[model samples]
Every structure is written in C-alpha cells, then in structure tokens.
Target: MPVRDILQLGHPLLRAVAEPVADPSAPAIANLVTDLTDTVAHWRDTTGYGRAIAAPQIGELQRVILLRLPGRPVWPLINPSIIAHSPEKLVVWDACLSFLSIFMQVERYEWIRVRYQDQQGQWHEAHAGREDDLAELLQHEIDHLDGILSLDRMVDVKSLCSREEFERQFKANSPYGR
Candidate 1:
C-alpha cells in the first residue's frame, strides 16, 4: 500500500482520458487499487474529510476509483463509467486533492447510474440519488476517469476560492456569526 503523489492541474496526463482496465485480474491493477485505498485512507485520517479518489489524479490512466463511505468498507470501482444521469442538477462546492487549495462550484446530476467492475473483476451497476455526498463524490471521481477536471466544469472562474478563503467566507456568511 502506497500513497502516490497526486498530479496537479496543467499536467498533460490529467487531461488525457483514461483507458479502461482490460484485465481487472492483473497484479499491477490490483496493486494500484490497494495503493488508492491506502492513499484515500491516509488523507481521511490526516484531514478528516476525503471520501473518494480517482486514478488520473494519481497519474494513472485507468478508469479506477476508490470510495470509502462512513461506517462502510472501502469500495473499489475499476473501469467505472456513468451510464445514466438525471436532468435535475445541483451545484456543490468541491475540492480536489490534486488541487488542494482551490474549491469550486460545479453542477452535477442529482441522480446517476453507473456501471463498473469490482476488485475481483466482477461487473456491477449502482444507482445514486440525492443521497448525501456519495452521488456527488462518485460523479467527481468518474469525471477524472474521462479527463474532466472540476475547474473545467466551473461556471465562473472567479467563483473559485482557496480553502482558507472558503472557510473564512462561510463563517462570515453564517447566520450565527455577527
């Protein structure tokens, strides 16, 4: 298990669409999945907030994602693709580990259906609806598989904020704050 270095914006690899995992049983792919899981877990333990991560963000050109839901075991999705999406949309603030400082508001489907493979090379499909951050996180990571970054999805570049600034603004705008 390893914590891979995250590729940053402007890296050509981040813009290239990832290739589908041809052999899920490959030892290298399996090792990557383990590394991704460890990386996500390490981030969550240190910062208390990561829920999902993508392969491109780690410099890998593979359609892989690792998700760890609260109270649930780590879920590995190999060759994940969004097969369906709802017309209804929602704007949410998101931050990427690759772009650690920037937070952006990107629009995403309120519901989505995705098809993917598990660690054991078995196929599976799942539906996610306005069910908390899981759906949003899933879409965010899947976008990475397709070479799409949250910055590209931003409605306005000016709306982007640094993590510190976002926290300050949120506090200032909160009702409890004088």
Candidate 2:
C-alpha cells in the first residue's frame, strides 16, 4: 500500500459527505484501508503526530477511517456511526490532518457508543468514555464522514490558535501532549 496525499483544508472535497461503503469485504475497500493505514503511518512517522485518518482526507468519498493509537494495532472502521452519546461534554483542543497548522477548542461528548464493521466485515459496537481518548477520536473521524470539520465545532474565534502557539502555550497542559 502506498501513502496517498492528504487533502488539505479548504479543499472542496473535504466538505463533501462520504458515501457509505456498500461492501466492507470488497477489494477496493481493502485497498483503501491499506492506503489509509500507510498514509497515517507516514504522517505519524514524519510529523510525530497523527492518531487516525478518514477516507475523505485522501479524496476517497467513502465512510471509512483508520485508527492506530499508541500500543494498539492499526484498524479500519467501515461505515462507522455514532449510535449513542452522553449529554455531558468536554472541551478540548482539536486539530486535523487537513488543517495541520491550526488547532481549535471544540466540545465533544464525554462518552459515545459507535457501531461499525471491521475490515473482515464483522459488525461491532464499541463504547468509549471520558477516560479514553477514543471518545474524541471517534467523534472526530465520524465527523469527517459527515463532512464536518473541527473548524465547524470551534467554541469561539478566540479558541482558534496556530500550531506553534498551541505548542508554546498549551501543550504543557494537554493530556495529548508528548
């Protein structure tokens, strides 16, 4: 699998909702998962940042996302959907591969239940809560499938900050900090 180009912010395609994958077992989807895995891996290796990526970020208008948190195996979520979520919310700084240079403060559910198919086409429901990073990550990736960006969820204009400023001023307090 080769690393594909990541569509940057302001790309028209980034705003387009992705189509649901009709057959998770299809060869095309397999290739797409591989490409997403490779692409995200490359990004994490080069930039020291990146936890996951969605198909739309690569110009593939399909509801697919790849995630590989530290110490976890890389995997793809096919046609993922958030089935339930807590009313409680947590505000955190969020960034995207499409707009790597900007970070914004966005509110996300403290917990979420997701339904999705694995690469092998098996259906599964997973839950993540405030204690787990997946709560935010799953929300972020699923938003991509719906053509929503972190920019759309920003709390306010003042919440927006450049990556450099984020690192210098906020990284020290971030749970996601290095």
lDDT per model, in order?
0.82, 0.91
* TM per prediction: 0.90, 0.97
lDDT of 2: 0.91
lDDT of each residue in 1-178, candidate 1, tens digit only? 7788778888999889999999898999989988898888887778655778898878889989998777888888998888999999988777788787777888888889999998778999999886656678899899898888888888778879887887777524421122
Runs with alpha carbons beyond 4 Å of true place in candidate 1 = 171-178
Query: In order, what is each prediction's RMSD in angstroms?
Result: 3.5, 1.0
Best by TM-score: 2
Q: Find the candidate with the highest lDDT and give its number.
A: 2
The window of 10 residues in a row where model 2 has the poorest summed lDDT is 169-178
